[model samples]
Target: MIFPIRSKAKVLALALLVISAATWLYLSVGETEYGRSLGPVAPRFSPTASLLGDLESRLQEAEEENRKLRLQLGEVRNEEQGTGLGSEGENSSHCDHRSLTEKCELIHVAIVCAGHNSSRDVVTLVKSILFHRRNPLHLHLITDSVALRILGNLFNTWMVPSLQISFYNASKLKTDVAWIPNKHYSGIFGLLKLTLTKVLPSDLSKVIVLDTDITFATDIAELWAIFKKFTGQHVLGLVENQSDWYLGNLWKNHKPWPALGRGFNTGVILLLLDKLRMIGWEEMWRLTAERELMNMLSTSLADQDIFNAVIKSSPSLVYQLPCYWNVQLSDHTRSEQCYSELADLKVIHWNSPHKLRVKNKHVELFRTLYLTFLEYDGSLLRRELIGCPTDGEQQETRQEALSKLDEEDPCYDFRRESLASHRVHLSFLPHQTPPADPYDVTLVAQLSMDRLQMLELICRHWEGPMSLALYLSDAEAQQFLRYAQASEVLQSRTNVGYHVVYKEGQLYPVNLLRNVALKNAQTPYVFLSDIDFLPMYGLYESLKKSIAQLDSYRSPKALIVPAFETLRYRLSFPKSKAELLSMLDMGALYTFRYHVWEKGHAPTNYAKWRTAVTPYSVEWAPDFEPYVVVKRDCPEYDQRFLGFGWNKVSHIMELDAQVSRLVFLFNGSL
Candidate 1:
């Protein structure tokens, strides 16, 4: 290695400057091995795909803690056993005659009404059996005439001196019976034979009856200890029985003398009265009232089919009980804590035929109790002799309450003060102009038989009276009356009006050209032409001045298109310029209106125009465009693809991604 040519050209320029600095650092880090790199410090990662994404996120948190411990072990084996009662306190005294517990006492209960009418819905069932009785009872309101005569004087002025109240009357019962029925006796079997033969108690034993639109929220000593744990020596406790009570056929040949189940609701019972007076329940209520056996049980389901045939032979003494003890109120179960779940309501029952309607929270609580006794116009014996009156009869009762404040208003006191002031005043008077364009344009064309010379140049350029329709696929009517007597615009439009349509195929030309143009097109605007497009001289006055400037701004519930034309020609021996541009790409010239083709009920078919234009886009030139092709037969003309032009450029890129400036009126040029 005896170098001399200038030190072997400086050792070949230091070995080509160390091979051009290692080919410029491997083309700047191997020119991005998978592309893109300017030089960076390495970091990269994958620790075994980050420990398999942290063990697939702790196996989805141990399958969500084993689906919450199998839904808390199927809700601890579907729980069950019930009973809860709460909320009721204010020194709560429905006459407190203590018995707190020794299995309960304070018994003097009596709800024995004579001719019981709904006495203001039995004052919410004697305020839900005096807010859950556990003693301190006494209602015994036996009545005679004035249907519970003002609920026995509002229960003798809201009773409660340990309650004790009585009223007795069927002219003081001593048997000549008659509890109620001079005439009106349909249901509740003439008031359950006027309460077990003239108001109960033939040595009482235990009674409960109920049904004046029931309502007792719990504790009638916990429903008398579940009615002495199902009346041990049964006579009645009620409840269990619903297979809609053996759906008729006279309960399958009458056999169920004590049937054990399927019909009870004498709307909440309890009864035992010493086994209803030793099984001759008052001589079966005097032989069901001298054999009327409730008109021989002809099904009015009144005294619930004669207490289900006098307890069908005593099916182990009759008990059943629990549907949360008598809920009833239907229209799919009523609510508002169903009247404070009245002690878990051992009764509730308003049994709907829409229970006397009114409810909007009882019409705003009787319009706030008629604006809190709208100046009390007494007569409950002058509000029980004005016990709380004077400031001179409350200032002469506020000047006779402003002279009887429009005779105590209330039919929902102005709809509960207009739904508690959500305002509604309007009294009428406002129409300042603007309301005119109610449609009227009608052009229809649709002829066929190889377009009778383009339907005689659209009846020689339609000068009004245009509604042709013709369609005839297999030509008849003597070959369309010999091609309309050699067409001269069908001998100068004999007052242009034809509708033919006999095409029995291709579903008879889409249902006989939309049912002969929706039953003889009587125009409110239609124009669906096809006899080879030749409408150029101001195309029907520029589509009726763009539909009267779209019915003067704001009337476009549809028309967003226009401008079209296409008439090329050439096809051999028996015609074929590709069958004349497949009959000029079949979108028969269009125009619309007659209430948008009477809401697309036009020429029915195309599945009733895709169910009357749903999700929009109905076609058949749903308004075609491009230099409205007036005449293009040149070397098979192609003015850069026309009308329905790539479906109006994919409906203008879906109307520029749903609506904005969408004015399209092309007249074909490219």
Candidate 2:
């Protein structure tokens, strides 16, 4: 038997050698003749049946041996590198199953967006996730009521498959972390992460927490797979800070909070809820915070400082994630080492105050990724919903996670109730509806349901696109849509757009509504006015002609249309500027807001508008906010002023600062 095997081996070696020699001889020729293979210089000869069969058998044996040897080599390398084996005790089989689970399982993510202007960052972040996600997502958002309402309205229109969104009132958790002093610009909201274990449902075993300024470039399922790699003692996963801010070497008198070696950034965190609850994470962190605050005054980085302090004392509680997972793009560091080693970025963290505009060599790439999601048309995500697994899909697994929590927890009822109250509904609003036909100008205004009557009047006279941002509840918004549909003037026109914004616990956000309206206007020109104002007949065409005559549509100019108001709401609107002037002389009409706030529109100089032949330039004043026909890209309204006072003034001030000249047009009045 040994002699026969040896003979077969010798034949195989000789056969391989002959094949190698032929290939080498063919390659030695020039490129033009290489493919011709020397025209089979020697005549092809058939080998005996017995010899061919023996050779084929030997080749198969050799290939099988090679494959077995490679498997042995891989096992040896994995053992030497201390790579962990799966629960099944087989590395290869475990990896295959793990990958399959990652693709099909549900992923839970938590984000904190507690104040105004957070929508921009949250929108970009969520968009990036939905853009690259494969597994179903159960998003847990911690936010205030205002943020909750805005985000709910926005996400309600998105019909992403297997996507479930839930909101928790950050105000409910405010008291939990308010005692921890924080100087971060996000205020107490920055510390909201400290309450995640308390904010989320007790049944949820783990969740990926992220800051709003991060954008994902890879499938998040890959990141979730890291959780399976966590050791028994590890309760959190985080990447080390890229900059020297935590090293206390930034400047002469820099007083950074306490941190471990280079410190771990809190921008991206993987939480093991079961492990944390079993180890009494809340009590442990409270003790750590007390000790750290004794030496330091307050935290500049909020929860990041406290998280590092705890990790410094108990290092085994954390699993160090790779740097590429959270590529920090602050001015202090571009994460050059991570970028050089990585083939593709997993997540981009804009941790600096400059955000996407941060000064980094890779800023453009990061900014482009963010903007791609920022401008991404969300309607594209509204495909037919593919129902994800329900709570009963993994009943046993969920119960196991739930069993980890203390059964006698005192705050369980309160936490559950609080979360329930803030849980927002999905798919309540219609998809964003744009006008079917394009227009030269869009009439932009904001109003509540009480002002729904004015829409018909304004739409009838304007005879152009009307972009209205309505502040109403979900029910009220539906009712307003029904009303608009029933109206002949509004329903008959194809150039009326109704943008519904949810009204929350805060006061009327007039400027916020205005900004929403202005931003939604798709025309080259927009008429920024109040919903209560009635434009004169032929005002839309008149303004179009005036803009053409002055050629101001392309310039940073606001063509002021003189406004007149009468006490009687049912009075006929003026047909022309001449008729408006006659009414003004007879005291039947006065400039809009003239008696109450003259400086607001006095800059337009209504007296000169009475007889002006051509558009006259009006220098901007402090409170000047004339209803004007301006390019849609003019300065946006400041959202800080929610109520009536100083709402329009700040917008006008920004326009003036940007040198947007205001000019009075004599075409018509609003």
Assess every candidate by TM-score: 0.20, 0.55
Which residue segments of model 1 deviate by more than 4 Å? 1-54, 64-112, 115-124, 129-143, 150-215, 218-305, 310-670
Q: How much RMSD separates candidate 2 from the native structure?
A: 19.4
Runs in model 2 with CA error above 4 Å? 1-68, 80-100, 341-343, 384-670
Best by TM-score: 2
For residues 1-670, could you state the per-residue lDDT of candidate 2 as single tens digits? 4433334444555565665555455345423342234465855445578865665675576566656655554555445334443221221212234334444588999999854357547877887888777778889999887578667766653445577889998888988889988888878999989888888999999999999988898778877887877876999999889888788957787978777889999999999998899899999989999988887878989999999999999999998777777889877663755655334578988886676667778778778877677656554553432454443323344346555656488844432222111112221222234444333778899888888888877877888777888877645644775686688776577666566665554467777678777887778888998898888878888777776666635556767777778887567667766777888888888888888989888888777777778777888878777777777888888665655688888887777677546655555677
Q: What TM-score does model 1 achieve against the real structure?
A: 0.20
Clashing pairs in 2: none
Q: How many backbone clashes does candidate 2 have?
A: 0
| Residue-wise C-alpha lDDT for candidate 1, range 272-388, written one tens digit per residue | 676666766766644554454334434344455546665664466676566545655543323333344333334545543354353534334423332222212111111111222
- Give each model's whole-structure lDDT: 0.42, 0.72
